[model samples]
Target: MDLIRQARARLAARLVVVTGASSGIGRAFVEAMAPSGARFVLVARRRELLEQLADHVRDSGSHAMVQALDLRDVEAGRAAAEEVLAHHGIPEVLFSNAGHSIARGLRGLVARPDSVTRSVAANFTGPVCHALPLLGAMCTRGGGHFIATTTVDARTSVPGWSPNVASKAGWDAWARSVAPELRSDGVATSLLAFPLVATPMLPPARRARARCAMSPEAAAEWVARAVVTRQARVAPWWLRPHELLHAAAPVLTARVTAPFSMRLVDRG
Candidate 1:
């Protein structure tokens, strides 16, 4: 227990900036890590929830700040990052977890182009806007961590998740490309590929009985651990083998998973 306490103490000293902190895995992350002593900057669109979360964090004996900004606005993201830098100095950790998804299908994009555009901006471009300013500073400082949540769909497309798959794929490509460039400067970047978590983001119908879906707390624990340990990529144990098979025999893998994947599609 002494070793665990020491580890918690070390992790608690770092400042962590979390996007999407109003709820879900982000809230769980705040709950899991705040007691360990880490100060947090919580960013989200909902001001009320952010404040409530801030109160919770302060109650836990950790400092908490709230930033209410829509990430789809690139300039806003940059501005928020600057404010954080000015007020709190360079953050040791950035949990770039803000994202959006169109769960129905590509039809939603055709029916609602603006929503689709915002979703793409939120998942890919928005985080990059926030990250660019901080990454440069982290490079100069020679120490910092940038962690973002991704999904297995980034690599393989699912039946009703075209927008989500595309957005994640774009982010995965961009982040992976930039990872090596940051390595020389000692800025660690990680893309955590989560399969499915039982969060509000998942529809009630889907979340009702998804045995394989991880709890938000479980996902948050992995994310917090990754931030503390500076892990480059966090993925389930089974994901690698599936990725390998998909790479080795794309057609065969797709054929095998088609029925199963299609079953989860919401045809509305």
Candidate 2:
């Protein structure tokens, strides 16, 4: 299949649930893909923003439904699934885009337990709590897609980013573990393990790396396409080389990456 055809074949006219749908990358996805004629479950604690997004979709002549959900809550996932299934189908696609990014180093992690809690909640367990219930239905339907955004951290580490790295590591593993199962059942799953982008999640140093930063809009477009195309997972075509370098030698890669940050956690 051609790239666009490959990317969106699975997602067309499907129900998509996007958590953290208020702004940043999540909003970018909705705005980018609205033309595709999909039903939406827009999840975020910010009702105002979600309503704004839904209004935008309606203005564009596409349909969107908003749900105010705090992803940190255990029930948010199930409630979202049920909401989508009620109006639409069992969400032919799920985007677990809610996440937390802390600009603290290891020492700061000790000082701030709450950051870890939020990070873990949004990055790891949130997706699990939400996606598991939908899996059986998707498999039975013989088609669906699950996608979550993981940062560059899971591939390597930098100063002041341990929690993000660790949280996304858990999230990444959760996606990978289910990927094969989903694939076998004609359901597709992927982790869009993105490189540093212009999303709100970026720290200043990471933002500086934005000399090459993908626009949230561009990133959103790629993700939307991937759903139907079923590439399974995606990163920049260029990231594979860097990912290979990290895979071969993490310590060296970490050392190299540490210098990229202005703040290094000097304490153990």
Candidate 3:
């Protein structure tokens, strides 16, 4: 079978949980997998959007349960996890894709520190807290997949996007550190280091400049590939080379990129 067929076969009739399912790549992913007959637990802060998406899933002959809550509320997130376990049982696949991005210089952040707090909560603490219970449940079940949507920015520090980059980097590191333990218990983890995708998450200025950004549907295909292959990490071909350059000469790379980074911040 082709990879798409393989992914469909594996996912058919399986219970899948997707965070940030209201729009963008998350919504696109659910739509792509709906035809495969996978049941989904859709999560996002928007109730009406998720309800609309759930209706579409139903139309595609798939089951969808909508959970509308902000992931940043740790208590609420834990409660939602408990509810998912009780109602849907343990999901065979958990796509922890909810994220927040803040593009601010240090000067701006010093004035509005709440942006940093929001970034850390949404990008790192929120997802981790929400997934903790489900992860344990999956471990007991003996077979499950955990997929996280990260960014290429997580691999390197960008001057204008410190909070967003740092938080995502923390998540990436945490997932990598826990992968071995999850594998020992028959649970697999995949971290997708996505490039700029034309999603609502992008700032207006960035979105305008991202003429080459991948569409949400295209990004969803990458997720499906990860589902089928259970790869530990999925990233662009140029990512490693970029990382190497930064690692080899961090100061020089930073100096060379400083002008561009300043421009990005200035635009926002």
Candidate 4:
């Protein structure tokens, strides 16, 4: 049972929207959240996969609507959210969990600007597209939860993959800015950042990064609890102090971690 289920009747009272619902963390999210007994809007690019996840969630006796769309397009966010509203009303929790990582850096992909741009839009701008309307609605409604699954890259900039770091950093800054505002209205806002996860988003050559990676199911369940319970922020508890230090002296940690990360990434 979910820790958020303590007030089952109250919590089950509204829909929840989770982006990146096709595979990895997204699919795991559908599975993790199914038992919460809330109507769900699952959005992703894989139509069949989303439908399959929907069937599985419904088998658990929960309601779900699967919409296949590309968040990179951004307009798709509005269309998908609008559909959810038309059928299920506003959601209680909005989860932005879709993202991918590339091990190679900009210098490595000099010829593929389009590819780099897509990654940036998907990892960063997608959250803004999905959340702006939801934020407005949730604020007006007086209570709701919003979660953005950022990357540890949001903190440490990678030389090779400037797009990923830059984009996710934008996401982190936006989330931080919005958190205080949302709290004033009783809406919980949180940003969950992960190191390399063992989810399918893990690139093969960089498999070493998932050495101590979190499982998709675990990430999903953890994030589900985060948005639902209104936990202010979450990361590995031990990292809290490090995060504080990172805030106080990002360049120091960046200089320290970069060489180590570079060597590891270079090895693969």
By lDDT, the best candidate is 3
Across 80-111, the per-residue lDDT of candidate 2 in tens digits comes to 77666665778778888887776566667777
Once model 2 is optimally superposed onto the true structure by TM-score, how far is the C-alpha of residue 30 displaced, in angstroms? 0.9
What's the distance in Å from true for residue 20, model 2? 2.1
Q: Backbone collision count in every prediction? A: 0, 7, 0, 3
Give RMSD (Å) of candidate 4 vs. truth. Answer: 2.9
lDDT of 4: 0.73
lDDT of each: 0.81, 0.75, 0.89, 0.73
What local lDDT does model 4 show for residue 192? 82
Task: Answer with 1 or 2, whichever has the higher TM-score.
Answer: 1
Which pairs of residues collide in model 4? 105-160, 105-161, 106-160
List candidate 2 stretches off by more than 4 Å: 1-12, 203-209, 262-268
User: What are the TM-scores, per candidate, against the unseen true structure?
Assistant: 0.91, 0.88, 0.96, 0.87
Candidate 1 lDDT: 0.81
Cα deviation of 11, candidate 2, in Å: 4.6
* Top of the candidates by TM-score: 3
| Candidates in order: C-alpha RMSD to true structure | 2.3, 3.2, 1.7, 2.9
Best-to-worst lDDT order = 3, 1, 2, 4
